[model samples]
Target: MGFADELFDLTGKVVLVTGGSKGLGREMAFGAARCGADIVIASRNHDACAEVAREIEAETGRKAMPYSVHIGRWDQLPGLVDAVYERFGRLDVLINNAGMSPLYDSLESVSEKLFDSVMNLNMKGPFRLSVLVGERMAAAGGGSIVNVSSTGSIRPNAGILPYAMAKSALNTMTEGLAKAYGPTVRVNTLMSGPFDTSAHDWEPESLAEGVRPHALQRIGTPSEIIGSVLYLISDASSYTTMATLRVDGGIP
Candidate 1:
């Protein structure tokens, strides 16, 4: 194979993507499968995950396993990890892409339940999964872990304060894990900007205002994320680790 083609190839790799049922997670799962990785699609919806898994197998001719579990629930993660290893034999990449940022009226109205839910999914779960998986990856040679974070972590506002806090913690965890699992397993953060996904209710006016601060002056497309995902997961980023690669539209 050509150098560029070989660099991005994932012939025998196994990738597990959380929240793989829809949105950016779905796109990343497809992208990885297309490049020759067997995929594990984990999400809360069993049918939805199965549907995506089927499509991935049909289109890419790669093995795709659908797993259902709530990422926020810490107790459920061990089973998910076991299922992947049992089916795939090994996991070469993990994309912690499942996250939620619920809307609330005001800072005063944000309940402890809401805050804890945000932290559990966005921070706690990812950490537990990484510890479980990263240790194995380190022992079995090496692997890549991409923690999907948001620009809001650094650019926090009252609107997304709790979610932003969680993401910020995720960012810090990525760096720490990189050191803990090195020099074999790679750990990094994929800091994203606003994208036009089902996750957002992007009205025209809101969309326009959202992208105003970006240098690209536009919201990113789901497909546009594939390049960054591929780069981080594949050997293309061999020299990269313990870094936060921003896929944002140059939000400054």
Candidate 2:
């Protein structure tokens, strides 16, 4: 392999990405496959995950396994971890990219159930999955994990307060896991900005206003996240861990 390619090569690595059916997860799965990794794509929707798995297999000639999972359920996570190891025998990379940010009219209208939903999905699930997968990775020699966070974690707004709190906790988890699993496994966070993707539900005028504080003056595109994700998961970042890389267009 060429020197640059050698530095980032992921040949024979098995990557598991949560929420891999679409958006950042889908793109990261494809990117890893392109780098010669076998991938497992998981989401709540079986059909969606299967479709992306099929597409990645067709395009990159890489093995892609798809599983439907609800990250909100703690019991479901162990099986998800088991399924990856059972199918691929090893998992070298994990992208905890699944998340939710439901809208409520106001803070007063927020139900306890709604609050739990956000925390369970965004924070609790990731912690449980990471611990299980990270132990395996550390035992097997080494691995990398990239937890996807949000700019909202640092800049909470009324509409997504619960989501922000969950993401903030996720960031803290990233640091704790890095320390706990290090010397063999690395853990990091990708604090992302607003993006123009299938996940977006913003009007053009609203999006334009939202971009004003960002130095880039535009929403990120899904493909834009691939480089950082690849760097973190591959040998390119062999010495880096417990870091939060900002892909947020420098929002003020």
Candidate 3:
């Protein structure tokens, strides 16, 4: 097979994408489906997940199933894994894309509840889910994991200290996991810049204003992130692990 043919083809592989109902999650799920991987989308919204799954199936003619679970519970992850195995038989890739960043005042004003909520969802949830999936991947010989981190983790953004801290920890965990599960289960993180997603639901104007400084000079689309996701999951990145790929539109 040609280099391009062998590197990008995902035929017969199964991928599980958390938070795959909307935004970047939905886009990546569709992208994987297009690349010939059967997809299992896990999110808290069943209706939204079903809608996206139907759309992927229509567009790519690949199998897509939606499972609703709150990963932060940790307890809920096993059931979600079981559901994926039940539906897809085996998982070859995992995209820990689901995340939350609730608005908070300042670091001095940050509440314990808010801090824990952000850390639990953004950091702890992905770690727990990875453990569950990594074990299966190891037993099956090999697999790939892509954690969706944020640029805020490296470059702090005011008023969201907890979110940044959790993402920073997640980035660290990505490197740790890659080493711990090395030579079998490849793990990496994508440190993304500002993107226009559900943030519009909170601060529409600020969301629009936040994209001005990037090299792209515009907000990124969910489709833009899918390229990096595809590379990490496919054999194109066979030699890459313990790395953080930035898709941040040149945000320094």
CA lDDT of every candidate: 0.96, 0.94, 0.88
Error of 2 at 80 (Å): 1.0
Evaluate model 2: give its TM-score. 0.98
**Model 2, residue 214: C-alpha shift (Å):** 0.7
TM-score winner between 1 and 3, please give it. Answer: 1
Model 3 regions lying over 4 Å from their true place: 1-5, 201-212
lDDT for each residue of candidate 2 in 1-252, tens digit (9 for 90 to 100): 899788889999999999999998999999999999999999999999999999999999999999999998999999999988889899999899999888899999999999999999999999999999999999998999999999999999998999999999999999999999998999999999988788778798988897987899998899999999999999999999999999999999
For model 2, the stretches where C-alpha displacement exceeds 4 angstroms are: none
Output candidate 3 Cα RMSD.
2.0
User: What's the TM-score of each model vs. the native?
Assistant: 0.99, 0.98, 0.93
> Considering lDDT, where higher is better, how would the candidates rank from best to worst?
1, 2, 3
Report residue 105 deviation for candidate 1 (angstroms).
0.2
Cα-based RMSD of the predictions, in order? 0.7, 0.8, 2.0
